[model samples]
Target: MSLRISDAVVWQETGEGISLYHTETGDFRTLNETGSKIWLAVAGGGGAQPVASALSREFAGTDPALIKRIVADVHAFIGTMVDQGLFEESPA
Candidate 1:
């Protein structure tokens, strides 16, 4: 499956990262560089594996032991995004 941002939302680039506006809720959220990378990967239909790979690349210099944890975190983050009406999972 792939993820897509809500049609009711719009995003803009910011110095720190990216800002997303949820038009339906009139709420806005800011994501850091890493978060934006994850969001983009999913939004572009890259799926969970690509998101995990992207996260892995970002922390390539870090400990290898944390790889699995990072993947779990990415999945959790994606779920949270879906819960917040920021994204929807779709068939590839």
Candidate 2:
């Protein structure tokens, strides 16, 4: 599944990171580089596989063994966001 931004949610890029605001619920979230990349990847319709691929490429040779854990962590993190009402699953 991909992800859809909540209704009326606004996002902005700042030097520090990415900022998100949901006007209807008054919920806001701030994300660092990795988070921003994940958010953008999802917003662009990249599903879990593509998301994982991006993460893989990001840290390709740095720590080959850590890639799996990193990808899994991102998936889990995104899943939690869905539960938190920050995002919704979308059709592929």
Candidate 3:
């Protein structure tokens, strides 16, 4: 149930940030700032926990509970994208 970026797809930074396109489904998503950051991190080939840790450091002032909350939110967001086939887990 983890969400990860699809390595097989190609992304283009457009006028409004970036959009990811899946040639298979012809589905694309335009990302806002937070989404863009997370997308870049996943595209860079790091797993979820590392991204969460990086997010905690980037935001700062986030206590443990808040960090967990943010991580949960991130998971939810990514989960939705994955469910929609915007992302896929890497092969083991």
Candidate 4:
């Protein structure tokens, strides 16, 4: 599945981490290191597959199993963000 970043959401990078603000719902979320990377990948307008591929290349020492696990984790995290109305969902 692909992710669609909501237009109503505003994201900012702070010294601590990245913050995501939902204007429509008046909610906020903070992303840690891994989350920040996933958020950046999604916000870059690429989908899950592309994000997985990017992660694979970036962490060269990661085994295939670990890469897959990370991809699954990213997908789950994206699902939560979508459920919270932080982004739109585009199935692929």
What TM-score fits each model? 0.85, 0.82, 0.76, 0.82
Give stretches of model 2 more than 4 Å off. Answer: 62-64
Scored by lDDT, model 2 comes in at 0.80
Off by over 4 Å in 3: 1-4
Point to the candidate with the largest TM-score.
1
Q: What's the C-alpha lDDT at position 33 in model 4?
A: 82
Model 3 lDDT per residue over 1-92, tens place: 34466655679777776788887888767989888888788777756667777886677555878777878877776777677777786553
User: For every model in order, what is the number of clashing pairs?
Assistant: 0, 0, 0, 0
lDDT score of residue 14 within candidate 2: 88
C-alpha RMSD in Å of predicted model 3 compared with the true structure:
2.7
* Better by TM-score, candidate 2 or 1: 1
Please give the RMSD of candidate 1 to the true structure.
Answer: 1.8
The whole-model lDDT of each prediction reads 0.82, 0.80, 0.74, 0.81
For model 3 the local lDDT of residue 79 reads 73
Worst 10 residues of 2 by lDDT: 56-65
Pick the lDDT winner. Answer: 1
Better of 1 and 2 by lDDT: 1
> Which pairs clash in model 4?
none
Off by over 4 Å in 1: 61-64
- Model 4: weakest 10-residue lDDT segment is 53-62
Query: For residues 15-60, what per-residue lDDT tens digits would candidate 4 score against the true structure?
Result: 7678988999999888898788888888888787788778766774
